[model samples]
Target: MRTASPPRALVIVVVVLAALLGSAYALGRSLVDGVPEAAPSGGPLTAEQPTAPSTGPSASPDPYQQWPAEDGPYGARSTTGDARVALTFDDGPDPYYTPQALAALRAYGVTATFCLVGENAQAHPDLVRAIVADGHTLCNHSWNHDVLLGGRSRQTIQTDLLRTNQAIRAAVPDARIAYFRQPGGAWTYPVVSVSHELGMMPLHWTVDPSDWRAPGAATIAARVTAGTGPGSIVLMHDSGGNRQGTVDALYRILPDLASRFHVTALPPEL
Candidate 1:
C-alpha cells in the first residue's frame, strides 16, 4: 500500500538475479571438490611402495675362465685299477722310424698312444693319419719339446698346447686327443690345470725306459719289459734321433707285453 510495487517487473528481475547467483556458487563448489590436488614434490602419486636396491652378491666369475691363472690340478701318471698297460711314444712320426714302430705294433695287433711333437706331426701328416686309422689315441706334446714350457705364463702355455693340438688336427681332421704331456715330463700345476680345462687328461709316464738316449735295442727291451706292469704307462721315443733301437725294442717288448698284461691304448674317455 505504501510504496506500492515500484514496478512488478523490478520485483521479477530481483528474483531471477538471486536464482542465478545461487546456481553459480553451487557449480563453483562442485568443480572445486571434483578437481584432483597436485602431488608433493618428491612423493609418489600412487600408494604402492618402491622396491629397495639389492645388496646380494653379483654372479660368480665365469667358472670357465680360459686356463685358470693359478694351478691346482695335476695329470695322471697311471690309470686306476685296470689290468692294462699303455705304450706311449713321444717326439714321433719320424720318416725313418715311426713307420717301423707302427709296423711292429700292427704285427702284435696292439694299439698305442702317440704324444706327438707338433713339428714332427706337421712334417709327417701321413703318419698322424696312420696313427688315427689304426685306432690309436693322440696326446698333445708341446711344439718344441720345451722342458720349461709349464713355467711360462698361462697364455703362453695355453697357446703352446693349442698350437700342438691344431697341428695334430690338421693332419687327422677328426683325431681325438685325450691327453696332454708336457715336454720332458716337466709338469707344473699350471700345465695340469690348463690341460684339464682343455678337456684332456694330464699324462705322466710310469715307465720310461730312457730310450730317447738311443740305448741298445736289447737294453731298451729289457728295461721296458722289466718296468712295465698292470696300469703302467710306458714312455718311448720314435723320433728326435736314430730310433732303430726303439723299433727293434718294440718288436721284442710288444710280444711279451701282449702275452703278459693286456697292452692297450688309453681308454677313449677319461
Candidate 2:
C-alpha cells in the first residue's frame, strides 16, 4: 500500500524550523570569526585593549636636518676655527686715544682688528700705517660713521663703501681690507650684497661692551670679560668721542682674556 502524505501544517512548521536553524548557525560562525584572540592569561582581547602609538627614537626629528639657509654673506669667523678669540676696535685712529690703545695692545702683544671710519682713516694715515705695521687686520667702518648708510640706495652704499676702502688703502698702499662692518651693526641685504661684490666679508661682533658710551673702565672691563667666550669677536671703540675708559679697560681686559683664551686678530684676508 502507498504511504499517506504528511499534513500541510506539519510540512510548513518543519520548513520554518529548518530555516531558523540555518540562520542561527550562520550568525554563530560570523561572531566567532569576528572576535579577536584573547590576550595572555585569559585577559581582555587585543581589540578591547586599545593602546597609544610608540614615541621612540624613530619619531624624533633631527635638529640639523631643517637648518635654515644663510640669507647673507658669512659673518661668523674664528681664526683657525679653534678655541680662538678676536679683539676688534672700531671708529679708530683718534690722535688722542688711538696711541694709548695701540700701546696697550702692544704691551700685551695681542694683535687685533681695527674697523676704521673712512674720514678718520683719511685724516690719520699715519695711524692706519701703524695699525698695519703692528700686524693687525683692517676693516672699513663707512665714511662719517653713518648708522643709516645701510638704508641708502645701492649705488650710494656702494660709493660709500668704495670711498671707505679707498681711504683705508690710501694709508697703506697694499692694505688688505678684507672685512666691512656696518656702522651700528645695522645690516641690510643691499649692504651685504655690495660688500660681497667688493670682495669684503661682512663682519659682525659677538661681544659688545658698549664702551662707546664711555661707561667706566671697570664696567667695560667686566662686560668684555664676562661676555667673551671661545670663538668670540669682541667689539670696542677706539674713537667716536672720549674713549679714555676703553683705553684704560684694555689693561684689565687683555691680561684676563689672554690668560683664558687664544686672543688673536682676525685673518686680514678673506
Candidate 3:
C-alpha cells in the first residue's frame, strides 16, 4: 500500500479558502449587525438628534441605522457601485505627510478620512481642523493608541474614546466625529462596550497596505489595488511611522481608483 500525503498546493488552497471564508463571515456579521439599536433613553439617541440624521422626510429611521457604524473607525467601507469609496489614513493629521497628502487629495478633488490619535490631534489641531475644512472625516484612533483592548480597564478605554471625541469637537465642533478604529485593530470584550458607552462606532479595515513597512510606492499601490473592491476599507498610515511611501502611493492610486470607480468620501449616513 502506498502512503498518502496531502498535496502541498491543495493545502495552500485550503488555507486560503479558510481565511477568505473567515473574513467573509466577519464582514457579513458586521454588516448584518451594522450598528446596534439604541435603547429608548440611550446616551445620544434622544438628546443628540441633530447630529444624527432622520430616516425619511417624515419617518424616523433607527438612529443606529441612520448613521451606520460601517465606516472603519477611520471611515466608511468602499463598495463596488459606490461611484467612489472613501480613502482613509490613520494615526495622522501630521504636519509632514498630511499637507502633501491633502494637496494631492485636493488636486484630485477627492476626500478622505483621518483616524486621529488623541496625542497627535493635540499636537496638530491645525491639521485636524484643516482636514475637516478640507472635507475629510476625522475619527478616533485612541488617546495614546494603547493596546488597551486586550488588557486595559474599561475606564481607560472609555477615556481614550471620550477624550479624543472632545478634542476633535474642540477643534471642529461641527465635525460629527462618529467612528473609532482601535489601535492595531485590537479589540476585546470591553472594546465595543466602551465604544458604545462613548457614542462611537468601532471600525476596522478590510485591506491594509502595510505602508508603514515602507514598501516602495509601486508595491504599496500594487497591494492596495489588488485589494480594492466594494465595501472594502483600505488602510494606510499618515503618521506613527515614516509615510512618504504612503503619500506617494496615494498619488498613484487615487487617480486610478477614481478613473475606474467612484472615489468619494463615505457619507455619515446614506
The model with the greatest lDDT is: 2
TM for every model, in the order presented, reads 0.72, 0.72, 0.68
**Candidate 1: clashing pairs of residues:** none
**Can you list the residue pairs that collide in candidate 3?**
71-75, 73-203, 78-231, 79-230, 79-231, 80-230, 83-262, 84-262, 84-263
- Candidate 1 segments exceeding 4 Å error: 1-73
Residues 1-270 of candidate 3 have per-residue lDDT tens digits of 999999999999999999999988877786799864444454555444545445567875444343444434323333423435667798887899989889989999998778898888888889888998888877788887786554688777776688888887777777777767788876654676567556666667667888889989999999888888765667888887788989988878988888876676556432
Clashes of each: 0, 0, 9
**What is the lDDT for 68 in model 1?**
31
Model 2 lDDT tens row, 195-247: 87788877888788999998999999999999988878899999989899999
Ranking by lDDT: 2, 1, 3
| lDDT of prediction 1 | 0.84
Global lDDT scores for all candidate models: 0.84, 0.86, 0.75
